[model samples]
Target: MQDTLHGDSQATGSGQEEGGESPAMDPRLIAEVRQAAAGDRAAFESLIGRYQGEIFRMVYYRTLSRMDAEDITQDVFIKAFRGVETIRDPVMFKPWLYRIALNAVNDFYRKKRLRSIFTLFSGDREEGQAPEEDRASERLERKEFWGWLGKFLTRLSAAEKEVFRLKYLDDLGIREIAEVLGKNESTVKTHLYRAVDKFRCEKELCGFLKEEKP
Candidate 1:
């Protein structure tokens, strides 16, 4: 993986993990990426076409807003294209792209000083009538869980927030998350444990999790 991220020879070859073609990529798509990295416009477009929907969903799940998510999604691809050469391991491109999307989200929040996740709870409280999608019981539940998460997440350090968000909400495995955050697997596990402990202790959310299907 380290070799792949560094040069054209590495990028142009098939990605082999554990002595074979990577389970993470289709061989054809890998070829297209290699071509694109060599200045093939159509190949690059193919890459973008393949990833757009998944990337948009990733952005939306984090931002919880269509408008901002759309904006950030576009930004992510543009950045990916403009900086494709900066990507060391083309095989891990999806996770790499997600990392960019996540960074764009963080930057957006820093600039706007807004917390979109909290917006999920407020829904229409300022207007006094919640959106139909967010009824009273649901509103109460979301607010309660969110309030708990605030205190819980706040207890975490910065790296813990990124690791927990990626591992839990994003459902990324430890190695994938390690690649994304540039951390080791054990560190990722430790953070996940700490974050989950807080999550389980959250008064309202604990019951919801207990009731949730496995």
Candidate 2:
């Protein structure tokens, strides 16, 4: 997987220029989303082409595994294709798509948790433990960064983790995050602040917070 932490802002600004002005989503894209919602297969493929990179990045940030992220990204779109017609407002497509992506990530972890429980009961060792030599290699740099991140996240409650990821990793604002998480804005703010305070106390992550200005 790519070192997504440093490239987040750039990925968010992918097609935009140096002045920070973002062009509006193409009207054609909106039309395509609506058409896809109405069961147009070709339109749905167009929508996938438009948003796949962004959705893949979002999943990759959460999973920290390129292969898992790719699989989950495909799953997200599959769900969207099945449920698109249920969407009421075409203007809300981006957020709606993101909501699906968030749910897919949550479901992925839920399944993983269940598997862990089953593994424990069966007395099975976990798969994919890297060799000590491989663990020390520079090839694992991104994985090591995720390990550091996992340590910081372990201090937060589940709610805090959801809010923090939506705010920082997915780049959603307070209102948007509240809508996605089905919480009120004040609740989202509370979780975000608590999460930030925890991060602020960690010397290893303090510089990261400064860079993010969060």
Candidate 3:
């Protein structure tokens, strides 16, 4: 977000970030969120109607995907809808909802990391490399800054990537990230430091990539 590898797309606030009802969402959504908390399926569906797009956008931007994000968004809602009934306070649902969304992103990344690892070991990657036309179709998959940043993320140990994604992509304060991640704030900061160091090194590599001149 703060560190753009190239063209920047503004990171708008999440729906709840609008505070006390988002214009982008129906006012009924507040009722629905509360209802879902009370085990109302119909109300939960209505809640999904309101903020699904926002959650999807967050996932898609960070994951650089639509299909994957779409699947994960549904997963987020299903988890939320089920857990909503157990949540004690409706007011706290916003962050609770986001935590679900974040988990979806993490799961998506884990699956991707596995795919990449498999591809690396299979030698079949050469036969399956993207065709030229496919490259154009998938171009948004290459937000220059994020594309580079993601490579570094993949290189990180699982704990480090989990910690870093919360700090940077989710923009959670270090303390908040520490709570979600079950680490000391100082430990979280160390992950952020390591992640940044890795990102800077990778950005340097991109300069070399650009120098290739086709």
Candidate 4:
């Protein structure tokens, strides 16, 4: 989750980076993905080692609960392990894994019958209630962006909200997002553009994001 993009630029249909660099998939990782798909236990374990933290963080960002995130992260990998061979292209391992995580999160919410995934505040707090000033300031600081973000996102349609999160927070490019959401690139772009238009109108949030963006 550094500034660097995760997958190969060309395979993802993104442009080359500065200095004319077009990063390719690492051969060793590609081998691991293929081996895991072919039922190599060690290779699958290696893949788990590389992605576990990222998967956990992604789940944590959505769930906002360590316990739920951990459970969902485990379930996501379990499902992935069972279905790895279904992934036809090695270049798509990251997005394929992400798709699994997204479904797992949705299923979690569906069973719980909780608030929409768009809700930002955690715990027993009611939506639209201001959190007590002294409550878990450190954790709030970490998630502060989302607190501000949830306000703007409330006005967006479901498709727009998701497209925005995938593009900006999840750091998936448009093509990868389309693959994950089972949508066409043009559809993804339309949603993303509408979301961006809404986001640009929120001057305070836009300025805050500019200052906070990594």
Give the top-scoring candidate (TM-score). 2
Per-residue lDDT tens digits for candidate 2, residues 38-130, read 999999998898789889878877876666788899999999999999877776677788889988988988998999999989998755434
- Per-model tally of clashing residue pairs: 1, 0, 1, 0
Q: Would you list the C-alpha lDDT of every candidate in the order shown?
A: 0.67, 0.76, 0.65, 0.75
Residue 148 accuracy (lDDT) in model 4? 76
Off by over 4 Å in 1: 1-23, 114-155, 209-214
Q: Estimate each model's TM-score.
A: 0.65, 0.76, 0.57, 0.75
lDDT for each residue of candidate 4 in 5-83, tens digit (9 for 90 to 100): 2432232223433122224679999999999999998999999998887777678667666667889999999999999
Least accurate 10 contiguous residues by lDDT in model 1: 1-10
Model 1 scores a TM of 0.65
Please give the lDDT score at residue 38 for candidate 1. 78
Instruction: Please give the distance, in angstroms, between residue 55's alpha carbon in candidate 1 and its true position after superposition.
Output: 2.4
Model 1: how far is 32 from its true place, Å?
2.7
- Pairs in clash, predicted candidate 1: 5-88
Please rank every candidate by lDDT, starting with the best: 2, 4, 1, 3
lDDT of 3 by residue, 41-159 (tens): 88887778766766776676665655667788889888887788887755556557777787778787788778888888885563222443255345554445455666677889877
lDDT agreement of model 1 with the native: 0.67
TM-score of predicted structure 4? 0.75
